[model samples]
Target: MVGTQHAARILVASNRGPVSYALGDDGELTSRRGGGGLVSGLSAIGPDAEAVWVCAALSDGDREAVRRGVGEDGVRMIAVERPVFEAAYNGIANSVLWFVHHLLYQTPLEPVFDEDFRGQWASYQAYNAAFADALAQEADRGAAVVVQDYHLSLVPAMLRERRPDLRIGHFTHTPWAPPDYFRLLPDDVAEEVLGGILGADRAGFLTRRWADAFAACCQTLLGATVTTTPAGPEVTWRGRTTRLGVHGLGADGDFLRERAHRPDVAERITALRAETGAGRKLIVRVDRTELSKNIVRGLLAYRQLLTDRPEWRERVVHVAFAYPSRQDLPLYRDYTAEVARLAAAINEEYGTPGWDPVLLKVDDDFARSLAAYRLADVALVNPIRDGMNLVAKEVPVVSDHGVALVLSREAGAHAELGDDAISVNPYDIRATAAALHTALTLPDADRAARTKRLADASTALPPSRWFLEQLRELQG
Candidate 1:
């Protein structure tokens, strides 16, 4: 156990850690480092920062590592019971909360908060309690703790109750549903979720729009008093105030530019160019097949483009990378299949002897994605709702020849990138199709200029700085 002897002055809590372990055939665990805002932020703070990352044991190897007390320095992995973790993580977080936030639920036949849901809710509570207990044990007096995403929404309050001396912050990486949409959760559950987040000293979002939506929910449901400040908004409930701040996470431009030029990525670029054919313009979209990504609608819009504009036939190819996400949930698995089905349909309808209208890859390949970014003439990023679509930011940074961005207004990235992008309504397939056409036809100089501006906006708040700023704000 990482006890008081290793108490941390700074702490980060999330469902996933910066490193994961895989058990080899020989029974040795191989550790793989992860990359994201949190990992980059922690690394930027340096090794001697006295920071500890409290995360769950997400895999069998992770559980085994917990048993063996084998982990990277400044990391504490809690081995929650498998059933409990699943019920909370998949059953509630991914299945319930994700659907609610993203507005992915079908109104006629879903979200029945029955006995099964109650059981899952209990597990969710236990899951959060485990994290809260672990964080309370590891935090030093007045330590600053940042909890990540919806998976740990309840942790801030739970931890606050346990260690009032600690300064805790909660950042939601998903969109905050509008008050009406948010109330879809059972009355008690809605209040509980809002109250849990309000428990933080600071609650952070990816955009001002989402932050406002959160405040509206608190005001409408919890009767929290909200006030505007120079920094941002503050929601006070039960005589405790939680300040809300917006931090739009940006692309690691230096990393993407350097990594995109690697020999491996170059090889992929060549291969993709060859597969796409000579003199053919490329439209690229890279995304996890999360339901909210609106991959199907994007494909439908592309099909519309082919139907409406025959002149683009054999002249343009859409390179789509729809990697699987949350396959443990049946809904996600079905969405992935639907994506595949539609991609195949587009090819069948528009493909020719020399031209394949859409080149679809379901497997995840970072090198390939970077290659696509470099080769894209148009970058399609149409999400139903996103906290911030990093793909929208990254393509511009990595594009060798600047790519025109067809962005969705619903994405959090739209707040920053909309002015320079050909913004479209995600649900409007015809409008998105028109936007893609406009992007494809944009003059070279115009596209290049827009891309440069987007690249700048996208890197305005890099991952390390984003994390540090939040940490600083929490400490203050």
Candidate 2:
């Protein structure tokens, strides 16, 4: 039974928390916390609704912090065992769901329902159960619970089974694998995944397309009642309604503008300017070194662009910050090494003593990345696939000289930013290279006009409104 407590306690759970920690030389864990859509969205969860973030801890320091509870009010961090996080993050979330969406795996070469896979599935289940148990403990009676991403899909159902009064919402930040692709999972697995999410009062995607895909899964696999309406659609199982909504995420321009003015940012920009010398059109990209990011392909395109068009040789520089991710996995390690190799090759092939064509930084430094955005004349956001590339939205809002964006059609942000961007197919090296060339050479007036449009599109659904819209619709 839904009750008035929906306005009170709210819990946000995901693989990554708003903060991360590291053990210092003094044997004390130091924590770094900051902003993003999730941070801002949960911030708007309001005074009445307490926000407790239960996230998996991957590092020794993270475990220490989790044990010590090093966080601000309303932010509760829980660190699962290292093995659980490894299998859950690498084996299940990235291996299974990521491949399902990007269609990255060759089905013929894929292993299905094998012993190794089943073991990983167990880890995945246990990890999600951890979040569900935490939510059930923290959420007061009738509290509203919002679970984030495919990683924690099972939590909605498990939590609801424990706390029926709780109003739960689940949002998938990746494309829903089509029913055909999803069928690759064992039949029981498929049914359970859909049913788990359906336990929520509301389920959300970034677009109508993703929502429709999810509805199709329910109708075909679960034998559920699926209804289409003007607002969107609904998935019903056992007389309970699970409304599907689209809350397109956005950038906090006002906050970013203020952050950009800090003295450290000014010094970094000055340093970058001095380092780059004169008349270099900067093409910037910031991405985690995940397989789906297609960093190797992006590098191929950059090289092809230089080889095919000699004129752009010394005119441009690509500032790539591929922050390290999932070093626990062999696949991730191999991918990172490949990226480093390509960066070195590109620099060697196209460099003088004074300049390198590609400036690749593996370390995750936000201020430096933001500084890149401010200096960039062309921001290359060619994600092989993304739920929503916040960089697409953030660049336009923070860019000092109104940077032109060369975007990939597969990105979730493409639906919103395509009209204003120089869109490209991430798979096609020549095409992406040409698109980059076009973006780099775009005129000032055109860049400004496109930047204005992109900024407007970026601001369409601010975090507060996005959060509120989901809350209001959940009640209906």
Candidate 3:
């Protein structure tokens, strides 16, 4: 509403916005801005572009701000009712869609789509409708609207129905499931999801593998026609062709390097070095305790390294930052607890009078993570399936002495950095342990050269460039 004098020509729609509000005990509201690819991309376009970001009001303060008509310039927050939000977000999006896309469901036990699921699906539709309505109200005729991630898969189609003149684009941040895996959803549900995405003028993914998987799902489920062209793959459904493009999000190398050297990060680096002992090597991983991150398996691999290679017992330390995520879901709560318990078991088994082999911290501290990145001798990023593991690209850019990357083949970043990284199957603990050993023992010169190449590739399509490229293509 801040820029209500004129309609916005460009729009970005997502679940979370660039800023959030907090209500202090003094009954006052304070706003904190967030940083990410979308934020950077929007900034790169400048205010002259007249872009409006449409997002959900996710917190109590945010809801209050919306009720009060308090908002940032060029941002609109839709306050969906709490019950509907929970049903759509936690019930459907996180529990069902996330599990399907990430292949996290245990085949015989889960995905019972009963009456409860149907109700949640209704709420999900309502959530998408809310965003579509907001965007329809704010966008100018022929405005380019970009919708983000799985949470709003239905938004593009809903918006299209309301405003056919608008240019619509949908980008999926998670890996797209293959036809076989995606078919796990009920037939009608799967078809609806595919048709929803096909309503876009263009659909973007992080890698070619995911993009192809999306097309395969559309063809298999919706009888869509897919063809390859010099530009990219195109999917034709119901007499409309939607172009598919890959925009692999990369590390903000300049920001990471600059922030990693700041006074706060330096203090954390000194503290971590003191705790890790002077000559011991540091193996570092920073991730949310999301099931797809495979943190438990990563810890088990570290344990295997200690058991198989005794020479590394006192010479190496594993520094893990497994921050909490989605604790509202019982599955994620259990996963977070398991990560903590396993870390304790390893430390209890390996700690000596002066050496703690595993230093585990569950707090979410960005400065500390940057410090660990700068100090890492071997960076571990072993996600089961990821759209793109930016940590695999980030550590190399910030490492003070150059770190060897132990990456998983399943990660989307592997498509870009596999040649330089020590790749392993995420499910094979022994192989991952071996990869870690190989990373640790890599020759200093070789490691430095690989790190340099990784840094270059990681920054090739930075956030701003990635966003601008997608906008340009969608505009065309």
TM-score per candidate, chains pooled: 0.99, 0.92, 0.99
Question: What C-alpha lDDT do the candidate models reach, one value each?
Answer: 0.93, 0.82, 0.94
lDDT of 1 at 52: 95
The full ranking of all candidates by lDDT, starting with the best, is 3, 1, 2
Instruction: Output the better candidate (2/3) by TM-score.
Output: 3
lDDT of 2 by residue, 280-323 (tens): 88888888998878888888889999998899888888888898
Q: For model 3, where is the 10-residue window of minimal lDDT?
A: 1-10
Better of 1 and 3 by lDDT: 3
Q: How accurate is candidate 3 locally (lDDT)?
A: 0.94
Top model by lDDT, which number?
3
lDDT value, candidate 1, whole model:
0.93
lDDT of 1 by residue, 74-192 (tens): 88899999999999999999999999999988989987999999999999999999999999999889999999999998998899999999999999999999999999999999988
